[model samples]
Target: MVAKSVTIDFEFDWGSRIKSDYAITHVTEKLLQVFKKYNSKGTFFISTETLPNSEKYIKMIKNAGHEIASHGHNHTLDYDVKSKMDLYNQIEKSKKLLEDIMGEKVIGFRTPAFKRSRYTDEVLEELGFIYDSSTTKSKMRNRYKPMQYANSKKLIYVSISTIRDRFPSGIKWMNLFGTKLTGKKPYIIYAHPFDFLSIKDILKLYDKNKIPIHVLLFYTARIGSMLNTLANCIENSQTIKNIILQKNEK
Candidate 1:
């Protein structure tokens, strides 16, 4: 059977530069609550370099029965990256950090900014990763071409695929409208705490008349739009329920 899963790749680019325990702690709890509410099991793509400061949160994730995976050491974007060696270094560093935190061998990885390059395939293979969810096929020239590297082993990229792949819409459109364009496939969604935390501030910028317009129309559509895709996934995906029940049991 085709396994259906919801992988939650969590982390903020801002965290690597400035260690904010408060932000980390709050987001961690919020995630735990989300898990409990949905009774969902997710794979957290984490940065090992910052794991030391996130011990409490890491344990919360694990204890709550979630799978911990690698995001990378520095949240570095592979496409923007300078060299293959740099990619390898980040993967290796991230693996070590995750293993140390979970006290278990790590197997999965997601790119820092959903970014990828030729180096992405080589490094994930070298690092012995079982699966990767980094490819977005967005408008980002460096990232938009998944078919270019489709033959790479166990590299699972996400995009919206339907309507005969006519025009990417909904979640798939977000990345397509950006730097890369991708076909929709199972919809692997990603977000940072700041994505949600910055909502109020973002809406406040608009005038009162515009606030409702943006809030009900644009803002809601832009953020958490994945929930619909996720709901579709949850309804159709059998493994997700099992994973969640199994994790919650622990």
Candidate 2:
């Protein structure tokens, strides 16, 4: 069987980063329902800043048998990061907060937007993070094949697989258009909470007038069968942390 890892960037809604936990409060519970139906597990790279009132849900996720990883404190673009210290602050604070909530160490880290800087690897290593899933083909200029992070003794950088050998194989497109899984080798697949949000739930969060007609149509397409498709992938991929450990044991 082919090796695969399922990951979710636990964060805000569609385009805007409104200071709310609607995704966590609503979408995640729905996701958990689907995951339960499939007997699936995954790594949720949570944004610590948004995890204030959602601690119960975080604990619920942990209790439901999922790995909690760091998605940084604020879901900001790393390119705008002024210094390595800034990046370190974001990632470290996030890790600490998650560990505090779950009473477990968070060794895996994935940048909010896969926007890693030149300082990313060094900062992650310094922070003692073992598994880094922030590396994608376009962002890190890495290969589009199954491989490991080279040279690093402690940090294992598992680059996320992409579609068309370019686009990151994430939720939106995968739901609308399926991924062409070719090889029997292991690969990484990622998702976000918004991808599983229903149109009614989305309208509850966003003003219906502001959301375009086409967007609403795509939202419909994104749900239903495609949403179930995501659950199917989750069942197939299992927990990403397990795959990483299995890789290291080899």
Candidate 3:
């Protein structure tokens, strides 16, 4: 059977507005268990600002045979607003911090909210990054511009696949089935730890948060079954590094 590459990307970020009761550790543990059960691996894009506290979790992901990548210092949208040097420092510092913790070179990056400055690609190339998974082809989102950056010698921009709703959700049946039906090989799916969280956990923070009710349900309900379906649908699973490496050999 031909092995079709499927990349599962996860974003890890926390800020002041984040709920105190929502524990990343708890959410991460659940995701790890799910991936393990499916015999799948994922690339976790971690925010460097959450370091020290996230050290153990990062270690846990690494030891689990998964890949780690940079998600910037904080969940800042500064990539579009900050100065070029400031942006460089932000990317450089986060990459260094993550490398220090992982004890390995960090080669992948996904911008906060998929917002990339004009200098985003230049900075990534300068930092020796191999690939970026920040762009989305979906046209529904107004803030995100539609553009495709073909893979080159310096870096590859892996566009995030969108579902009917233009969001990458494991539970989105149409997103998975439609992609397969359309013969879109090497599918990439991006998710957040909170997607696997329980409704009870989310309700605790719902009072103060304005998160939509259906959005919460879409992620929390039948998530396990949805993930399992995804695992079985894809012929092979791979990290972004492996994908690029294979492409380079071709």
Candidate 4:
């Protein structure tokens, strides 16, 4: 089995409040094309709210054999959550929506923007999630570990790889620069749908939505073209679920 896991966060334009689906509507084929060319299967961490606009594509990803994991119902930030109930609802609602549409028990989760409270994992375990891929830095061997919560339940923590050691080396970095800068082996790489958006569209959306300069800096390089190169470099790959199963076997 390959030591790497491929993941894509199915969300809208880079954390903006825009209710757009251009990436799902326009760029998934490109992402899938790269995966197919490289004989890889990935896990998709989907934000359930995007379903109203991107359900067909979500189904397409499922039909293509990628695992469906929850990214939360609305991709809300941790600071914005009013209470633990709100956070629980965000995760539970997404899990249910994904299960209903994909016709499978959704068992994995990755918080939106990789930001979560200390209680997030506990909540995930309580919600019956088998694993979470919300962290970007992992210190253990292979960057995978069984985390025990207050309730004595264990949830596996799967990490997203970094670029040039960048803490938040998200998909856009891969889209623009490839994965040459990724971390050590057993890499768990992640990208967003918007990472595959065309440069012209990216510019238009950035201009229209006034995407912050900090977010804009990540897009200085040409986007929408490095996916094939990125995939070509990703060796035999599997969904995060399979990766975890294989690890448990070991």
What TM-score goes with each of the models? 0.66, 0.85, 0.80, 0.84
Query: For candidate 3, which ten residues in a row score worst on lDDT?
Result: 8-17
Candidate 1 C-alpha lDDT tens digits along 30-76 = 65565566776666778765667777787888888877788887764
lDDT string for model 3 (108-210, tens) is 9888867777778888888999888777676555766554333346777776655554544333543344444222335666655654455566676566575
Candidate 2 positional error at 5, Å: 1.8
User: Candidate 2's residue-wise lDDT over 155-205, tens digit each?
Assistant: 777777766555567867666557764323467788777777776776775
Mark the 10 consecutive residues where model 1 has the least summed lDDT. Answer: 160-169
Clashes of 3: 0
RMSD of 4: 4.2
Candidate 4 per-residue lDDT over residues 150-187, each given as its tens digit: 23248777767766665434555555545654565567
lDDT of 4 at 147: 31
* Ranking 1 against 3 by lDDT, winner: 3
Provide the RMSD of all predictions against the true structure, rounded to 1 decimal: 7.3, 3.6, 3.7, 4.2
Candidate 2 is scored at a TM of 0.85
lDDT per prediction?
0.55, 0.72, 0.65, 0.72
TM-score of 1: 0.66
